[model samples]
Target chain A: MTVAPMLSVSGLAVDYQLSSGALFRKHRSLNAVADVSFDIAPGETLGLVGESGSGKTTVGRAVLRRISAAKGTIVFDGEDITRLKGERLRRLRSRMQIVLQDPYTSLNPRMTVADIIAEPLIVHGLASSAEETRVVVAELLERVGLPRDAADRYPHSFSGGQRQRIGIARALALKPSLIVADEPVSALDVSVRAQVVNLMQDLQRDLDISYLFIAHDLAIVRHISHRVAIMYAGRIVEIAPRAAIYNRPIHPYTEALLSAVPIANPKLQRVRRRIVHPGEAVDIANPPSGCRFHPRCPLATERCRNEAPHLLRKAAEHFAACWNRDA
Target chain B: MTSPLLEIDNLHVCFDTRAGTVQALRGVSLSLAPGETLGIVGESGSGKSVTAQAVMGLIDVPGRISEGEVRWQGRPLAGRNADRDARPVWGKEITMVFQNPMTSLNPLMTVGSQISEVIELHLGLSRPAARRRAAELLSSVGISGAERRLDQYPHEFSGGMRQRVMIAMGIACEPKLLIADEPTTALDVTIQAQILELMAELQEKMGLAIVLITHDLGIVAGLCHRVAVMYAGQIVETGLVDAIFENPLHPYTQGLIRSTPGLDAEEERLTAIEGAPPGLLQPPAGCSFLPRCPIGDKGCEAPQAMRIFETGMVACRKAGVPAWSEAL
Candidate 1:
């Protein structure tokens, strides 16, 4: 049929060892992400969303092999990338790139904008001559809303939003088939946020690039993503099309999260209920038996407390973890 | 009814800096009745935080409220009250939850002890009793393992947990009002929801009013009962939340709302308010927003002034800018 998806993950598990593997005593391990699986089709964007420490970042890092996966398979371009090491891993990194959250921190202050955008090309030998590199770098900077003259200026001179444009230009330097953007515009001012997001959407359309967009803001993710995945603790609590997740959430956590997002207009707030879960997030080191969300779940039952649930199909192409999905 | 809860009349806060006097808040007047959430919405440096700081009597030194009267519960506050040994009544009568909880909290102290200290000193609870109550308060704000977490340092908790701890500490003494200054700026969206829910629940249980100082319109839309739109150290528009949103009066308020793209909108291009906010060091002369005003009439050129209309208020020089209109 049509060639396999650009990026695919099955049974992906990422856990951090609190201590080393030396001691006789059993060291604790925090399961940052467990048994997570998703696919990013070519030219489509999948938004991964969760609160702080939800392990969404870990997933992005794992897919790029930045961190060692405890278990699972990562298939990129129909080849198993999970076991690739050294030279092979380095080669694969060019096709799948990352655009970090803070543009100020990601770009080297010492380097000029020209050098910053040309990094991936020079490293991967995509450009041979300085003149050829200059032409490519100029084109990228312009595409991301920066002027061609910006190539000579240092990162410090640019505003917060302009710096982010530089970061996007750098990510596209290698013409990466897939990109992992983690909170790309969250730190930016409200006025500039939209422009950057729109630019990204434009880049995706023109270049046929797929994105694994990870962020905390739903309103932002809703605009760009084809599918949305909500994370809790370290698991994908719900995953579905954008419309299904935002308008008709199946998981209680998802519902609460959707309700919690503040609307732009001040008037329609009465319809919003202040959902208060009077318990804390479960410890990742020793998550609750069965459902990790059981402690704070409003409709928790005996089965929910002890019987672990998986991604059960609640609707077409929609999956939820709740035992009582109907509820 | 009895002199309102806190009456801030003709308040003018300014800074006498090396450059010149920065007019932060200019002749701003607002009185809050107990159990009313007044949302002061504005962009950065709109003097929302300064107003909250003024209420707490914690305005930074060298920054003076050049003119105004601050009356708390019908008594003039000059660092004294009915009792002779009264502090500014800040942190006790009107506690505040700041934007970044990590910086606000004492990193050296345990979370539990820090919260307990407030209850012990203000509410006159015993150390043991205060610790017990602290655990309850922590649990009440959606913090898990409340007792165990009490002994943990601020760095040990996540961002959301840290904010919840600040809320617990702010409400420890049952302050009539809680000033949450951008409480969710550091948090992600889902955690922000949880925090808002917790804050609303606590307000209901404790019968506390909240003055939410934030730049996020979404929080203002979903939370505040009333809002005071601020610009260049002045309240340009003050009205009920619905009235303000449905019918924004001033050009600045309209610009902010238009700039934000709606979640459900099927549109492509978003309207952006061009240019940056004006520097307060040399405030704009005739109509601060005149440079960017889309509806600036001839009156805009001749010193912008506040106009009190029926629904709310507007500070525009436009002749026909109504307080409540679908024109926006």
Candidate 2:
């Protein structure tokens, strides 16, 4: 018997208001994330991959309660957090944290490593005296592979990799069961990216933490995630085990995404059929009906033009929102 | 052979820092074929961008192309030396798309006018023709309702949209060669795929040779025909994409592949390259990657200049190119 998932986002939606069209015009809502749903098992890493406007980051922020959800329920630890408010909401935030994409900007330049890490502890009232906070901060820093002396230095003093380590330290300060890592390594140098990703993996293994690892990087996500979720036009189209997703992706979008990723093997690289990418802006504010991706999908069919497929379970554990899963 | 689109022979770039002259690119050599996509792969400061800058003749001062030659279409480019503060190669035979769109684009200028400027300046088209060309370019890059978007500012567009505009600007006049510096590094995965596909398609349609600079090996694997792996401002590994991927002779190339997350194996522990990538100022003796060479010991003590194998090349003393039998 399997236990209920730790976090479930169902029919999640978000829309931001635009400027008035005329003197007494009705406000138009721009749908950023539309009816998106997925689940994260306990201690599982759910890799969310999508384009810039696909609203993957928005889903993460909504789950963390940093952004308001216009619709749907975010159930965490078996509790509905969609309408959760006041102290309960504040308490929920402590249980969930965010590690931002730009480590350099996410950290305050004026704040020392010790202060940055301790701020979360002090905010949550997890530590009492200043001495206790210092000890906790130092421990967190060391946990991310930083020397104890790194505690006193400001964020600017650290390299991009080092700054990310500080960000990880801060994220782990709350002992959060779920952490939203939004493009955590996109800003670091290539070689340095490995150091931080490895550190995060080690932390997750040791602490049994769950992660909503959001990134445009497929390879990195493939490295750390237990399962993968591919999103497009503010909705989820595919969800599967990491190996299943990488090796035998179900959805055409997933396949196209995988195909576009350059292989290190030259022979395969030369022979692989490229799913020629569509132009950048197809105006997703009002996405095409039926299949939002029909415009770019190589194997799109007439049935695709008139029918918007729902996310349905294809295998025992795999789920995909597409017409031809078996294809 | 018909003259390669672009050639760099014994290229060296250096910045006159207060500490000393920091050598960025050391004897970097590459030749591009017309309408081909050449992927330059390396870490940050690996001279990938430096190569692009030098080719565009946009190297900043006190940085200069201290030595070497950059030949374009069998002719040496006019400004062999970049001015300390001049946009020397703007809107000409070669164009560049920077990683960041908003910063590269003019916030105050309309998108149409920005692209039209390229056509007008480079191709010497009239204002009306330039505007029409801008609209066509915008439409080609997938910014629909191009007529309206032509008037839009960079801020009015999304990240992907702005990048589309950047692509439009780059190819407005149909440059013979396009240098894209980490074009999709700032984009999301799905969007990155889209942008990459678009670039590939555009390259085919326009028949333009492209210099795509990125650190992602996966990119070189898929999009690039030939790849040059740069380290310490030098081309450490140069070969066909398949050759380099299957048999990486350089330790740096090997370390990169091992670090990337993939489906090939379940890596319980990632084999990270040791120490930092040596600083350009000091670098390492013999091999630039000697400090972080995973397979290095005392055997790599001798200096080794780059050598070409059948389909690839490497700069390593102890290591020989992986034989065809070993690859399988």
Candidate 3:
């Protein structure tokens, strides 16, 4: 009787094969993302946050079916989309979209703003005629706060923030239920970045869209995300609601990452004790045994090195993978 | 009273392009005392980096320091032509760390040789002594396996480690002042934290006066003792770190603080500044922030001078003790 979440991904894994180069050479496999599982309800935003090489972007790409998942299922809107191919995958893709990080290169420079936005509609056969496509593009542009006149202009004429708006309009053209935005505002300037973040927040509220927001900037992530998942070395270390993750993170990696973020308030910044990870970052090709964070964890015990810990429910709607979470 | 360690008075920088003369820094000024950290906070094209480059005598080509005085230990090093090489002042007295380590570190040279080059040039030590000192400096910057890692080229090191090597080269001569322009901006938050902590530790031990130029106010809040908010190639506001963050007088400063999402405070909607920064091709005649100022009127039509308050200086016609705080 209960409706399923908008997107549910479980036990997802993505392994990249790096060729050693030469004849008769065995290929090496790198596990970019491993055993990541989360669900986003309708109109919800789930933030995937971690440092570089944390496999956060890999998780986002897997959910969009842009890259093949080595293992696990991606059930989107009650349909198993993991193995979908050809027409089935194309049809399913119309309901899910992606907005990339670099606004400068993401959009086709040759394509007009209207053509870029309407390309989806024409390809998907959502519109019958050119006039219908134009109407849709105009609406989408206006929805993303761009002037309707912008439909005729090229992407080069717009600023970085405006170009990002066009990208949003292109993503919105499909009117998808879910959007996978990877470091959407990281390339932007601080002032312009806030504009895009606010626009995304507004559009999410107006259109009732779900977002798989992947970013390394925790401040912007904290602003827009409803729930947050912390990934480290190809594994999800913790998942919790926004407040719980920010205020009371259980995982050692999450704790260090949060404490690492410098707040804008000098009064608070001066008095805070920063948790500096003493160990080197995890090597994804050869990750540490047991809990991946054990090497850098302040309270890591002997058991933490020998035995891997599963996601244990620490509180209501909070899960963390740590042996000595209490400590 | 002793003069400040470094004092920049009415600094103006311009680049002569084919299109037009780009006035990058217009009367920008700042002062740093010994062992004091001054953060220059601004968005892109706000001339934060140019100010640092000007200090290091690295400004080249069409770019010129039109006006201003850069005094090192109360000695003037400004008002000179672009070719004037202040070689003695550069490495031994003041060193700069740029944003991108990939570009800054020579890919052809090993990390050890790069550090040793600086030590040999500035300290005038023997090759072997410089090599030994390079390893010691690498270890000092918290790079593990420093002895072995030094032989590796820049490509072999990760972004964070390469930046650590860059820091080692920057402090190789025991410089009195270090200007780091967006040093950690390219790295991730965790790595950024590590690099920042290393810089802080180095600053304390060496008593290095740091001019930390960055777009992130959060980093400024955490690291700098004094802060300057730059807009349109000018310092819109300057004050102690606490005064600048707590009661920002200039509207541009207020807008920056408001636009930034607070890591601690969650809000439903972020208050984004309306317009983009003004183009430097034709710098604004009146107040540079006139177009974006929320409280601009007929009074802002004329040029506004820096108004000295009890705590700091703000270049605004209608500026006060952050009265807009409660209004927001």
Candidate 4:
């Protein structure tokens, strides 16, 4: 018997309507994310790795229902929340929380730490009185490794790592089954970044919460994620177990991305042959006819350029979308 | 060693803010040889950028280089008359590429004109000649259809392309030194590789010395010949990149390396430094990293100075001791 996925997204697509200030010009829509799919098991992390404009963040927002999906269905637990509306959507939101990229801007400056964490509890009607909310806030602060006295202080007093911890505490106040953490440690210092990443990992083990860890840093993703998905031009080119994605990436884009990451050791970095993929990511507004990455892919053939490849299983629990997977 | 191209001696920079005087840099010293690449690795508020600014004479009002001498090719470059003396060499000999290319390039001006402006100002070239050189420079940085793209504004370019444009302008006058302050921090990994490759190519072609200031250790290891690890306002360690990575004497450097998640390393819990960097306004008296150092003791309470090691210089009391290696 297989355990059910806590969150499942299928054929997810997000479109942004572009407005040209002309009287009779036709309205244009940019498909930010197209045909993306993934699943996050309870207590598992699905690292979504991509460059800028790859729609990784869009996938996270669409998963959280913060942004309406243009196409596809998002199933939370056993229910299809693709078209969840009104009170039903608000209630479902508590089960799914979002941790934004920049902690400095995510939290309100005027609100105290207790108020920030308690706001979610109060909104969900989980806490009865002010005393109850305070107790829960203190517990959350401790869980995130922040001191209990930190509950009374404002966001301005906390460091970047501490501020991120507060954000995590807020996300956890609702006992969310899944948290869409979009570049959670990108803005933090290197030393502080590790602390936050470790804290997030610790929380996962303790709470059994699933995380859609969206980040551009491949190494950090490898550390925190049980599985990794490589996205390019708003589509997942590869998805596999952590080792497979890093060690035996089938997709050409994945290989290029892995090679591009600079290793800390000079001896290895000097010896490693980097596969520099020429040209930028394809324009999402007007993508290529078949494969969006064909323009820059080194191993692109006539078939790759003419035919769009869907995710095909290459190994157990390893899937790659490439016509020339063997290459 | 080849008559250092840039030398910063006992540099001390401070910022007078409304709250208090923030000691940004305290007795920071470094020397870089001609055509060498030095990577300044430090976190936010570690004075790496301030050191770059001091060398370039770019420190504005409210922030002053209180104590130190900036020497450019054996000539004093920082003092009361530093600005006027350094003005001539600013773009012609020394150029800087900032972190955010979006804000670094003027949005109003066409990229071609922006590049031309630097060439015209420094090289005394005519408008037409500068424009021609600008297109060539753009092409040199790997931008396709450079002439046509040069006519476009900053907004027309992507983040990576804008950075390329910035690089084109930086090398337009064939500067002897280029200081890139977190140049690739804002770029994607692939794009960052492209930029790093471009910088390396430019350095090889122009024989330009580069001071790459960033928080990422990986980039430094790959690109830089030497590395300097800064904490608070001091250079805790400075050495050959290989030695520093292989055997970091300073506890902070060890912690930083261990904390960074290696791409190839197996999934393991990162060993994070417990506390945050001390506040600059009222920094700790002896060692700023004392609060976070794993092997720090009562000896670390006293002031520490850069001590000579087998491979590099480390500013820690227990640097060469057995306890430091045992702790790691």
Candidate 5:
């Protein structure tokens, strides 16, 4: 018998009211995330890759219910929790947590390391006593490769990488089954970034936690995720296994993003061809009608401009939304 | 071959703090020839930015250039004792572009005026001539409708556009050398490729030498002719980009190569460097990377200098050992 996935989101759409316009005039809403859907199997990582204003972060936030979804449903652990409220939402939060992008701003500067790690436990009432919380926090520190004595120090004393580890320890304090790590290593230095990525993988292996890794970096997402969803202008253009996405991307956007990434090997760097999308940055507020990516897509035709393409099955376990998939 | 456009010999920089002296840069030496691109790769606190700042003569108080000399076309830069404060080489000969375009460009000034002002000051052009030149420069850097966009302020332009303006300003006076420090880190992947491509095109057209400082090895492999690997404020390795990527002699360089996740190939586990960077409050008595290096030993407590290897220079004691081989 097969088990159900940990998280399933369908037709997720999010919008934000424009803050600049006059209050008396008509209100305008920015379509941050349009129709989107995906799933994260238990103990697997699903990377959400996109550029700025592509609604990748909005998808993560909407799933967590931090940001209200204008449309769609989010089902977690085989239960429909789209409109979960009050006690139900609070209860579900323990099973889901977020690791923010910047370690410098994500963590509280004044809080001691121990308190920071214990915040989740205290809020969820997971620990029996204060002493129990301390023990758990100590263990958490050790698991993240931090010294046990570091619990007493403040966040300002630590480096960017160490602080990120502290953030991870706090996220794991509740033993959450799902983690939404949003650009966790982007702020870190290259040398220390590997250590944090390794720690996250190790934690997933030992604890069997699922992760929705959202980032702008293609190489990092490819490394950490089992499956990846490519987002463009608030829509998922493609979803496929890691190998398929990297080696045989069907969508033009995925192909462009993959080719744009600089290969580390000098031999390959000289031979690879870079795809230059001859268009300006995508305007999220006033997006193009029909297919959002039509404006910049090199292979876009009149049919592609007049009609929006839905997710179509390409190969085994691979899906792409493109009018010219075969071409 | 022509003489190098800029050369640094035994560059040493330090910062005096209340607790102790921070040895930010230690005996770092590099040379850039005309139209050559040299990449300086290192993590934070590796002194990449300091080397750029030293070249620009922008190292302020508390941070002093303790020793060594920087030569511009075989002539030493104005040392501590100069009559009046006159920096002739800063904007006219050597210019720099910082990482963050949002803060680097003045928000209050229009993008056109910002570029024009540099040209006006450096080239002694009239206001109208400078503005026209600025518009031309904008178009040269790949910005569309450059004339209309020149009048707009920095906030009106996107991140990528603002970086283009920065590059245009850096090369406004036709500087021989440009020090771009993490120039494309803030932009997205697609936009980063565009900016890098634009830089390469400009380099070919104008014969511009660039000192590209970044932590990304992939970028170095893609763009740079030569590579310099910095660790603990010192250059641990230096070679051609191909040599450094293919046969990295220093352990740190090898670790960096293995640690970075490659888009072409997927690995089960990354080879992460174990420990944190050493504190810069005081220079270590031995190899600063000894604690974290995989092949380090007790003998590493003594100082080591760069040794000439077949392909390049390596500063580690057991740099070229075969035992460290076969790991990749």
Candidate 6:
């Protein structure tokens, strides 16, 4: 009775090569992501929450084959697309799309709305003629709650929220089954952010599309995601269902991140005890030998400092990589 | 409030752009007492930052305070020769912390020089004395290895550490008031919490008053004693943090509260305000939020003024009426 996942990524790792000097030509490889594993079920969102440079965006890019992964397998719809390239990769791109964070710079100012949304269809050869593409573009505009007349205007004429809608319309033009939305609503205003989040949820219900939602804002992630994964340094520290992750997080990093977010209620915020962890995330190139978070963890023991723990099952659907948390 | 420390009376700021005159602030008034934290929460183009800049006498040509005055300790600080008058207390008594620390700190100068410059200029300390005081200030802000870290440039420090250095420089002169505009917006949540904690500790130790301008309601709720909600360059509501959060009288305030998704939100959908804020150029004569107000009626077409209500000051024609009960 369990449906197969739309996208599955296991043991994914990405590395960036850094050249120290032009004369010496000494090269060093920085491991940005390591041993990351997750699955996105059909029509379900897997929210990837992490701070800046935690490799959340690297995971998203690796899944789409935009960047080559140094290790691990990325299976899309039961097909191993880890090494896809040439015509095959071009065809696979039609099945998945991406929406960037900044709407102001994502769209081209010179192109009209119709051209911006229709470029994908034309590039992929999805439609037959200009007339046919126009029909699909109008339908997409309506689907994303924009007027058809907007097709004639440029991106500079639209507001931030409206430009985001245009970007969403362009992403939907390919009828993508999976969307890699990287901080999609982080650059938006507070009131307009909800409208886009609601629209994404509604589209998910109607189209049965899965999403890899990458963001740093936990509250928005909790609102839109069905499953959540907390990442630190370059690994998945914890993964669980939304309620389980928020209510009973097993990893110390997850607990600290949750407690640090300020609540909106004044009365509740006054009495809330914040677990302010010291220092920022470790440098990816020179991570610690044991747990990457041991330096800042309050409950770090000798075992946690010497041995790196593998992800162990804590509940039916909860998994955490910590030596102290017992099942 | 025991003789307000800073009082802004009917402030109006305008910018003369190529297109036309843009009214950035329209008759905005606020009062702050000593050692109090007032949170100014609003979206972009809400004139919150402009109010802070005006209070600091930072507004320049092409954008002038067309009307009203800003008084500091019952002394006029905004008018002709305002800059000459404000120069005495501008940096020594009133300081500011910007959003992005990376851009605010000079890349060429070492962290020690930046902190020492402020101390030497204000406190009349010698070079070596100021440098020693700089290291002490850095340690007070929780930066480890303060002496070594002081010699390093800003590029060597992490984002969180750079922000801490900024705070160290901000408090080097023992300023009486601090104007922070989205101070923690560029930091992560954990680092933001640490910075907010540092600011609170500094306030308690120095008895410093703060004017915090940000777009996040959660930060305001946590750190501020009072809150002012601004919209389209006007103060829609101002009251105690508890009263505003519990029972918001203005429709804009109510909408903002409902729109913000809480950490423990049970509702599936957030109540979004439909339209975007109006353009500043040639804004409507009536309430700026009238077009987006849920319970807007014919009476809202006329300009509304801030009036005292049961809980606080609201600028709505139907402040405490029951008509909004169903609409909200």
- Candidate 2: regions farther than 4 A off: A21-25, A275-284, A287-309, A322-327, B1-5, B16-22, B31-37, B68-91, B107-116, B123-176, B187-207, B263-269, B281-286, B297-304, B321-328
Please identify which of the two predictions, 1 or 2, would achieve the higher lDDT against the true structure.
1
Candidate 3: docking tier: medium
Task: Supply the global lDDT for candidate 3.
Answer: 0.88
- Residues B1-328, model 6: lDDT tens digits: 5899888898999999999999999989999999999999988899999999999888888999999888888788885435455667887888899999999999999999999999999999999999999999999999989999989999999888898898888888998889999999999898898899899999999999999998888899899999999999999999999999988888888888887888886777887777799999998989999998777889889899788976679999877553234333
Give lDDT tens digits, candidate 3, residues A1-327. 155799999999999998878778998999898888999998999999998999999899899999999999999999999999999999998999999999999999999999999988888989898888888888898888888899999999888999999999989988899999999999988878988998998889999999999999999999999999999988899999999999898998898899989889998987888887787688888888888888888888999898878788899899998877752
lDDT of 4 at A231: 97
Q: Where does candidate 3 chain A have its weakest 10-residue lDDT segment?
A: A318-327
User: lDDT for each of the candidates?
Assistant: 0.83, 0.81, 0.88, 0.90, 0.89, 0.90
For model 6, the local distance difference test gives 0.90
- Model 6 residue runs over 4 Å out of place are A22-24, B80-83, B321-328
Q: Give chain A TM for each model in order.
A: 0.96, 0.95, 0.97, 0.98, 0.97, 0.98
TM per candidate: 0.84, 0.85, 0.96, 0.97, 0.97, 0.98
On the 0 to 100 scale, the lDDT of residue A272 in model 5 is: 82
Clashing pairs in 4: none
Residue-level lDDT tens digits of model 2 in B1-328? 5668888888888999998888898888889988888999887778899888888877889988878878776666523543433343445668899999879999999988998888888778999999999999989998889999989889999887899999998887778888999998777555676788789899889898888998777677767888888888888888887776776777777777766766466676665664566678866667777766655668677667777689977887644533212121
List DockQ, one per candidate, in order. Answer: 0.42, 0.46, 0.80, 0.83, 0.82, 0.81
Candidate 5: give the clashing pairs: none
Give the winner by TM-score: 1 or 6: 6
The true-versus-predicted C-alpha distance at residue A151 of model 5, in Å, is 1.5
Q: What is residue A5's positional error in candidate 5, in angstroms?
A: 1.0
DockQ for candidate 3, please give it: 0.80
All candidates' chain B TM-scores are 0.92, 0.92, 0.95, 0.96, 0.96, 0.96
Residue A290, model 1: Cα distance from true site in angstroms: 3.3
Ranking by DockQ: 4, 5, 6, 3, 2, 1
- Local accuracy of candidate 4 as per-residue lDDT tens digits, B3-117: 8888898999999999999999999999999899999998998999999999888888899988888888777888544545556887789999999999999999999999999
Summarize candidate 4's per-residue lDDT along A1-327 as a digit string, tens digits.
188999989999899988867868998899898888888898999999999989999899899889999999999998999999999999999999999889999999999999999998888889998888888898999999999999889999999999999999999999999999999999999989999998998899999999999999999999999999999989999999999899898998999999999989999987889887778878788899788889998778998889988888888899899888652
Which sections of candidate 5 miss by over 4 Å?
B78-86, B322-328
